[model samples]
Target: MTTRARNVISAAIVAGLLLPAAPALAQSDEQQRIRKLEAEVSALQRRVFPGGDGRYFEPEIGGTSQGTTVTAGTPSTTALTDILARLDAMEASLQTLTGQVEVNANTLQGLTTRMAALEQSGAAPTLASAPTPTPTPAASSPSQASTTTANNLTAMTGGASSQPARPAPAASGPSSQRLAAVQAIAKPKTDDAGDDEYSYGFRLWDAGYYPEAQQQLTLFVEQYPDHWRATYGRNLLGRAYLDDGKAREAAPWFLNNYQADRNAARSPDSLLYLAESMIALRDTDRACIALAEFGETYPAVAAGRLQSQYEANRAKVTCTN
Candidate 1:
């Protein structure tokens, strides 16, 4: 009886232990399979999204109270790249427009300055007044009595036939007195109507009354075309236009001054102003040529401020050797 009982008891204990081990082994196997499936899913996600380890999830169609449907999506690389390219293009366009606007503004400013200058110079004369010609006096015959007396006297003196003395020939050129008078009128110390017109105009120019100065200078040139100071007047007139930002208009005047009288008092100055006007107009090639011509024409004039101005302008234009 004791052997049978011991065998049965041992069998029951072994059966219980075996039953618990089977369930535990099955659970472990199921967990390992689940882990393997998770690893595969992670690898698939990496392949699909490449940028991150997070899985992509579609928006759930939650219960809708209304008929409208809502949807959302992540921005794709291609769409984002297109948007960036558009933004870059817009920036470039904006930069180009800004540059053009700046150029236009500069041009407008120059034009305004030129207009102001033109207004200041007074209206140009339509026609210069010509000098009035002097009338020659008619020759008068000697009185009859004087002639008879001369004849009688000649007869008494037993002289040959007397002939009326020819009037002395008029003197040639201006007299010393006339020249002195001109000088006095041209450079008077007081501010009188008889003062030198050229000096008065030059003073006005120096004082920045460009319009009035130009008018006075023009009148002087018109009234005294043969005067030596006419050349200076022309030069100053051109300078007035140039200083007022009317370079294009100034250029023609300067050219005319140099062309009309190459040996005039301010011919070299006219050429220099011409070069400056060309530079202002952005004609660097012409400006350089003009400067070179000035050097050739007035090489001796290279000592004063003129030479320094030439060098500075040349550098500004980036002139070639």
Candidate 2:
């Protein structure tokens, strides 16, 4: 009931009010510290893994005393698995391609071997017994001269005879005349050696012995210039060079075959080979022109192998419509 008792009672009331406010202030400060720690963790996560949703810290589960642990995201796991699968698939594809390349190489080698064998066994023509002899002026009468001339013309225009003629022995004017007279009287002899030589050359060509084949064919042409097989020999020589991958060298021989004997059986064949040579030389325009000439000149015989060859070459050269 005195002045000191009243002051003590006022101080107690003020202390009661201040105690509740102090607990609220402490709780607010704790919340601010937690927020600041979360901001620092988020900034570190961004710097460590910029483009990925990598592992990051989460707020403690129960309380601030609990330890922070990393948890993986579903997207990151899925991305890693996908990358491994893609690498495996790429390895499998590369292995498959390598196997296919080896198989193709082996197949090509087998084809080449088989083709050479076939060519070697199938190229020679059957041999004949003998060539007819030229007529002698003294033995035949005037009326027979025309007939003899006609026969000579027929033999010249004819395709290759199965039997080639033997070369006459070297002689001067009178001796040559006597030898011719005797030959006209005597029966013609078959040149079996010449036929064998021709067959050997053709077999060489077929067996891919190109250099040897060229030499043999050239010798045959030179030694037996008037033989029935002369035209074929020239054409085959050109083919040997062409098949040997000497297109530029082959062109001249093919051209010579056609120019020297246009009416010969293999003349058209020579033209076709010439076109092929031109294509090998990358002269498409010239190849096309040569093909046109072949078509114009040999319309009668253009339905079989020659026609097929022309069509294939035309496509290869990509000729205009």
Candidate No. with top lDDT: 2
lDDT of 2 by residue, 1-321 (tens): 989999999999999989999988997887778767766766765675465344333323223435433333334566567668989999999999999999999999997776544333323343353543432223123332344432332232123332322223235444566446433432223556565556666766766767667877778887776776667778888888889897866776776676565666677787778888889989876777667666766675455446667677777887663
Residue 33 accuracy (lDDT) in model 1: 75
What TM-score against the true fold does each predicted structure earn? 0.39, 0.43
Error of 1 at 239 (Å): 0.8
lDDT of 1 by residue, 94-153 (tens): 999999999999999997776545323422212222323332222122421234432332
Candidate 2 residue runs with Cα over 4 Å from true position: 1-190
Clash counts per candidate, in order, are 3, 0
